[model samples]
Target: MVNHKKRRDLTTRSVLIVNFNNDLPELEKALIPLNWECASACDLKQSLRIIEQKNISVAIVIIQAGNELQVLNVVSKLQHTTPDVKWLAITTQYPIPSPYLKKKLATLFIDYYHTPIDWGLFSNSLGHLWGMSKLQIESKKEVREPTLPQELVGCSEPITNLKKDLKKVAIVDNPLLISGETGTGKGLCAQLIHAQSAREKEPFVIVNCGALPSSLIHSELFGHEKGAYTGAERQYIGRIERANNGTLFLDEIGDLPLDLQVNLLNFLDDSSIERLGGNCPIKVNCRIIFASHIDLENAVAEGAFREDLFHRLNILRIHVPSLRDYREDIEMLAQKFLARFAQDDSNLRFTNSALQAMLQYDWPGNVRELKNRVLRAIVMAEQGKITERDLGLKLTNNNMPKATPNRLRTEIDTETLLEALKRNNHNVSAASRQLNISRTTFYRLVKKCNIQW
Candidate 1:
């Protein structure tokens, strides 16, 4: 092993080229904005030494298929050793023994070029490599053990206090388990903790544990060796490695498979995971923050999830309030979504009746549905204004069971729409138009109302 430790201080676009000949002159003409340095020695060992000494961000390999096995061996080592390093391969001839090798190299390397490489394309490739490097560096800087200010929005008591809790938790680098109802802004709360924590400078990596499959969840979370499993096409570092010194958010953590729960539990306690096939543990220095709509306490009690894992993750907790609990904030949040969708695009306005009707409505889907409905109404409403009928709720005969009427009006949404329509006139279009609903839906309301348009 050659020692280039002294040269690690240099900041340049170091290119480690493993070629038979020292082709310094040919590589000189290609213009890639950053400082360029190259090593043309075919010995990968020597090239790696130069890379370490020079802090090379990119490597261009020049190889030919003299023997089938040699080519595969060379490519394999390059892929593993230079996992994060971008690679550009230059082959002197075409139709190299196997087309599979070519395809494999294309997938693994940044770019591949045939004999007589185009200088323009080569430069452009290097340019893209350089831009990605910049983004990675910048992104990593934002998330590494950062101390971010509070990022949670909303001034309601729940939101205001949630920010305070997030701030307190941000200082501690431990597991934070957040529990909330669906659509209660748990994701935003997790983001706020990442933004405020010491790891704020590194990166915020979110993994939906429920979305991962039983077969893939292990590899996806812990990564795998090249031949670890059948579809192990390539060795890839998992998200935990990507957030090396930042925050790793495991969303819907209650849904993590039972086996994975064990792995995650150990990882949380020890900050380590062995890649699927590899024996060596990869040390990850990241804060663990998890969120779930379901109560993990209940999951543990039901024996569907691990009790120890839940205990490990619940070091800090933040409970996000459902939209119904913050009923006073409905109109405020609705108007925010309305303005967001209608910005410089549509001429949709909410009539006082429509606004009052919205304030009285029950948004089961929370902020997300409210946003979608507002955007939909803006696109579908032919009239300039949104009325009670446009809202699609009838205002008469409050038959639906009320969920805490102090915050919401006791009447059903359909009844509210009907009352708004009746007040406007039997005109279905006018009623639906005022309701901020589509014309077709308005026609349906006409039939439902037994009123002639």
Candidate 2:
């Protein structure tokens, strides 16, 4: 037993006990001294419900002498739904019964214990696992924070409109079609939608329909059975089945072969799939998000894509704006990209000529092209500054847009300032850097525009 004094010293933590041997009372008592709040479930259904209802960080599976296979299925199902939680298994039999079962157990559990429980060792491992889980969450937040819709590095009207559409599509559970030019961040938009939806905690699986060959695409998306084909050896789960109860993002969906499109349409219609060699239907409850760079409507008219399938996905649609559509955001995007790529030189900035060249040029490749150019410039720039030559852009007198008057410029400046502030979470310093202005100048403008943050 753990020391009773430790219970009052630490904050209470939640743990799910997957009890299969009717040992719930004994396990609950054993966990008392560690100050754990327990939620016990006897089967897979109950366990899933409790995990969804409560924020469970850890789970303890009690495996019986003859119930290894039953417990394995339960653990595997739970892992599919919630992969973040750390699992620990306890069994009455030592060395387990079968070698295969023992091997599978080793792969699934963080730690396992035999009967005559060593409370001291178990308590230490539990605490360490909890600390590790917290660190992993904090790390993900640091990486994902910058890419969240609100912080998406643009504040122009087109970008603002795109953000609004993303929010609207996120709250609803519908098949979404994201249309945009190649490299316009359509896949990123799909990820943002999944991150903001009710299925945020579930897996977000991506399938590049264009990357795989036509002959192998069908088996790859739907999976194949062992010995079902020439290369068959073991039963393989398909992408759709793996994404059960989560979000599935099919990138470059327009490239999917005409024959495969009908199969995809059938899956979308019934939310079920049949493995290549399997007979029974496997029901998958996952959100489908499709992204395409080409014009699907044109493809339909040209007989390359099915019109019926297009309509199925076109129910909830979002169009990612091209770089030229939001030209005002170029400077900010370039500066951000420079800051990200030029990590060692925080003082590095684009010269005025470079900014003018970027403004004058029509971006044929959109945001992705802009990012690559900035990265290349960082490698070629001199004396902590980037020039037009470094960005491989030459300015022509005829390409520049006509200059605006003082009144119009002032209105544009005010609107840009407000959007920058909102996008940067009202952090004046961050917003100032985004606009390539000094903190003092940003504050003066805020006061001049009568903007309160």
Candidate 3:
């Protein structure tokens, strides 16, 4: 059932050979007959440049026994930056002398070979790797729809029900209340509602009640006249005015001051707001959407939040599920985040072990935590595969098999790397800490790039 056209198209991609120490005069000649376009790089730097300039699907790194450390340091760095390339490490030592070196080799290479190479076996593996790389690229395209928001990317029961609820409420102009755990994408849910609503063309303004200073809460929500306070320099238009004829999303609504709740309730009751230091009420025709991680019912009983305001804001409600609540969507969400965060066209895949670890973890931080873990793994993963260790999640049980990890794919631009180092004062440990990666990995990357601290 193999389509000839697909097979031909797949073989058109290039293969790069990086010569670190080993010599193979017949390697390129043998590969050309097998339908591979061969490119050569004398060193790691040249190989990286070739990968950047060409459509390389696989890289063959040739090294000798004594040069493991030098070759691996540069190889790991290249793997981190060019995850799309499936690397095959070919060495002269038949039994790979050092156990430590073998371990590193297994972690970083798709496959490794010794001298007197088996041409048939190597060619087959290379073709298979190239096919997988192409499949990953196509799979990414298939999973993502240009029109849908990332928050709405899943098909789990909870997300399906949430989408239905959003559709039902989108046309309604009543104030909406969304409750969810922190990092569960409540803001994105609010945005989806706004986008689907009648006010899609108008501005959608967001205000974090908990993040704003209490002193400036009033001025931030409502407009302020010039000379309203001691430091009032000029007339200021509040977020409400900016969201006129659109939607206003108030995040962490439970954090609004008690006095401000009265003003907010009044505005909800009569679509109007009184500017600070002004006597007139301005009619604002904007739909209000409120989201909070804290339970407003509990807050009301605690005398911290007004019950009247709670009822007013709770006319329409949506509760976004936490990551642990619907474990079925974890893989989909992880893939979406990986695609979103990838800086280049690298073919990166999650190993079976990594996916198993993700499924077993409690995900206390929900979607946000999963996203951050994937982002960090992209930088720290050895070879091109992301493993459970790379994701910083330990397997819960001993029953889980530790499969060969796949390369963690993402190409973080050099500028981001330099800036991270700069922010941490050229200290490798501090720089890696800032990027949430280990000092050892960051140090290798720093050394490979010859970046001056």
Say which candidate scores most in lDDT.
2
RMSD of each: 21.7, 22.6, 18.3
Off by over 4 Å in 3: 1-151, 343-345, 398-453
* CA lDDT, every model vs. true structure: 0.66, 0.78, 0.77
What is the TM-score of each predicted model, taking all chains together? 0.55, 0.57, 0.58
| Per-residue alpha-carbon lDDT of candidate 3 for residues 1-453, written as tens digits (9 for 90 to 100) | 236644654447679998765478788888888878888887665776566555567888877767778778777767765666788988888787888888988899888888898888889999889889878754542222233454586888998999999988899999999998666888778888988999988878888776566888899899799999888999888888878998998887887889999999899988999889888999999989999877789889989899999988889999998777778899999988777765453677789989999988766457877987887677566667888987888877765333212221112224445876665445454455444334444554555455665
Q: Which ten residues in a row are the worst by lDDT in model 1?
A: 1-10
Report how far residue 229 has shifted in candidate 3, in Å.
1.5
State residue 136's C-alpha deviation in candidate 3, in Å: 34
* 121-198: candidate 1 lDDT, tens digit per residue: 786787688668657744643343243343444678877787788889888987888887555778777887777777
**Candidate 2 residue lDDT tens string, 381-417:** 7788899998988977776655556565456557768
Winner by TM-score between candidate 2 and candidate 1:
2
TM-score of 2: 0.57
Judge candidate 3 at residue 375 and give its lDDT. 71
Model 3, CA-based lDDT? 0.77
